[model samples]
Target: MTQPGSTPSRPRRGAGCLQSLLVLAVILGLGYGASKVFGDKDSSSSSASSSPSSASDGKGGSWEVGDCGGPDPENKPDGYRAFDCDDSGATFEALEIKSASILPNAIQCPAGTDLIIQVSRVFGSGDNKKGGGIPTNTVCGRNLTGEHPGDAGAGGGQLVKGDCITSTAKEVACASAGSDAFKVLDLVKEKEQCPAATTEPMELMMAMGRPYDVICGGKV
Candidate 1:
């Protein structure tokens, strides 16, 4: 028989140290298994939540025909799109809903092809893409800023580097001055990219977030 709350084991008058060591090893093994299970759950949930969500009315972001959309980003209703991305005391202008990707920096694909794009249009994520509380371009497109030489327009940490994320219609916006908004008429693939579109599929999930409303050709 064994003492209460104790495992049955061969009794050795002078083996306390050895038994204690074996008990410790068993405890450690059990802890290791528990930690592995818990760690896996955490990793999976974080991976899923961090992944971008599917654009409603569409998944991945191919704006369907008749889908409520703006005009070709190049051509804005008032003229060209404009916005002051941050109050960083930097005086520069650009269009909204454009993912901060301008021509030359934007990915160019053949017209009338099916494309899935990403949008920084997620609101309540704190008006920025670093997944923290930073502004959009400041967070995502600084590398591509015209003011900076050798720009690659990379910011918005919410997105993996070099992934496709926004879209625009190639319509020409009459050049305007001192505005903070514009619109993209049809969906143009948006991403500060290398060459062709991305072959990877971004996962989507329902989020307790809002939409990012910025002007494209006119208004988003």
Candidate 2:
């Protein structure tokens, strides 16, 4: 991820090694802007409990878990509109909800989280009552079709140098010998820098909001 005031680094060229880079495509395709402040602001050392209840965006709109939503082009009071997860217009799937008071600095998402949505006004849970007050909440979710970077472990891993990638753009173990698996020999800054044996010089478009482009795969 691109941190404020920090230069973005390239993916490693070593075998089975990669830097953790969470790709945020929402900003580019869905009009969902990303903030530089992504770290957890919660003071508690323990993890907060999950809330599946409904929450308001202070604009009379409410949402709950298992819901898929995207920004409303009409600029409705909800600011966002819900859609079926199978719908092509759906951007993200809500996975968890937490109190905003716990996150004073930044919104903390779950391990597999790809997006974060914070509501300035909450209801039916936490400090907010049925009438609604100043209490707030944060929603963590995963992008419906965004790429996952680095070794996300059980969550999911994205394509990186030294990884064996499938035609579908999934990162698989290097040991998996198959026609679909292609080993990434190198990661270069430009397409021209790729080795002569390179077959697929896929350019990582604005990964983590990096200033420059990243071309993956080449012959050793």
Candidate 3:
């Protein structure tokens, strides 16, 4: 018999094996916790590294002044990819970058801008496929020296507020005093007609130039 509090007989083989298994389990648990903590940090670092510094350079960022892009052949506003002013497909050039919350009624461009491009409804994709309208209007500008990218140049750009005529070459001849021409109608259905009071109506054309199925009226 063993003496009081004296060492007992050696444990059986199965008992020893059980003790060893418990020690291994504790070690694995600690390792998993440490990995989780470090793994999260690594993931965060990777995300920050891939992000672009400015919206002007980022793939999904808002456009900046002087940026250029356009819609597809179908007249649908694409991703508005930025392109050089001389690029073949580039249609609209950004003149101002307004906050999404505050949009102005008239085209307010910086001095030296010769033309103005107004975007009323910009399309969206993915979950926003149904709608992706900007909070305010996006205005683009160009000089009158060269040809505009899209065919909708007729009646586009800055115009006189009064009566006007648009030509296929994207030139607007206005009879008004002021040199500002904003679109009165946009994106109408095919074959749709202008209002009765409209003295001069311009047909919308393809590309970013003019809205579809619509007409623009002005005074000379």
TM-score of 1: 0.16
lDDT of 3 by residue, 1-220 (tens): 2221122222111211111110000000100011111122122110111111111111123444655544333223223334455556554455455333222222333322333333323334334322233333344444323543212322323222221333221233233223444333322334345545554454433323222323445333
> TM-score of each candidate?
0.16, 0.34, 0.31
Q: State each model's CA lDDT, in order.
A: 0.19, 0.40, 0.30
Q: By TM-score, who's the top model here?
A: 2
Badly placed stretches (over 4 Å) of model 2 are 1-62, 76-79, 102-106, 121-135, 149-220
Worst window of 10 by summed lDDT in candidate 2: 15-24
lDDT of 1 by residue, 130-177 (tens): 222111221111211232210111211122222112222111112321
Q: What ranking emerges by lDDT with the best candidate at the front?
A: 2, 3, 1
The order by descending TM-score is: 2, 3, 1
Candidate 1: which stretches are off by over 4 Å? 1-88, 97-200, 209-220
